[model samples]
Target: MDGSDDKRLDDTLIALRRILRATELYERELAQAAGLTPAKLRVLQILSGRKEGNATPTAMANQMGVRQATVTALVDQLENRGMVRRERSSTDRRQTHVVIAPAGVEALRSAPSALQQHFVANYQKLEAWEQQMILSVLNRVALMLNAADIEAAPVLTIGDIRQDRGRG
Candidate 1:
């Protein structure tokens, strides 16, 4: 590649690294503020998104791209903290579901999403076409970086990074 192309590539990589670092730091800060580990907080967040604020452990494991054992451990910690409760599924008595307690909802509400706030604040200022362009570029970049193959959940927590590495 030409020198200008090399420079552009370097700049793009640096920007991506900055975004990743910011997300990692924000995850730690959010976890500390919520008095929970990132993984635990992520579990609660996933539960909170469910229709009834509950999900089966297997489902959570799939959503988080982690092992079921990892999700069980997180659920146990959350239950101990009174943030979640285990209940037998109504449709299937043989299955158990993890439900987020009222405290879990409160914790999630109180947690500050700094990265989201920053992104939303800036993103809202962009024109509609600009927003679309940015989304397209980000999607292309994700594909270029081979992240498209990863089964990432919609949750914004950084807990998946460690889980991904563990799998590798």
Candidate 2:
């Protein structure tokens, strides 16, 4: 590759690093501020938006594009910390819902807006052409890295973000 090609590659590497750094810093900030992992916070956000302030783990898993087992693990953490509790449904005794506790609501109020939420807010302000361009470029990059087929949710925490053990 020529000098200009090398420069472009370096620039692309820098941009990818910046995106990763931003996500890392955001996760740490959120953990320290609200003592919740991105996954847990996401679960709470989903529940808090519900009319009943609760949902089955399967429903949350579907919404998050993850497995029910993954959602169950997150719910288990929240329930252990008194942030949520499980209750059998009144109408469907066979169905159990994970209800956000008072503490969970308070955590949401205390935490910063999620990293992806901020990204979505800004992305929406871009022109249609700009949005399409970004999508095209990002898709190309993912394919270049052989990541196009990887499963991912809308959250932007990290590739494998660890739990925070409920600090707040």
User: What is the C-alpha lDDT profile of model 2 across 19-81, one tens digit per residue?
Assistant: 999988988899888988888899999999999788999999999998788888888888988
Overlapping backbone residue pairs in candidate 2 total 0
C-alpha lDDT of all candidate models, in order: 0.78, 0.88
Compared with the true structure, model 1 gives a TM-score of 0.65
Candidate with best lDDT: 2
User: How do the residues 1-168 of candidate 1 rate in per-residue lDDT, one tens digit apiece?
Assistant: 999999999999999889888877877777667766556667878898898778999999998887788788778777877999999999999999999999899888877764665787899999999999999998898899888777554445564533432211
* RMSD, one per candidate, in order: 4.7, 1.9
Give every collision pair in model 1.
none
Cα-lDDT of candidate 2: 0.88
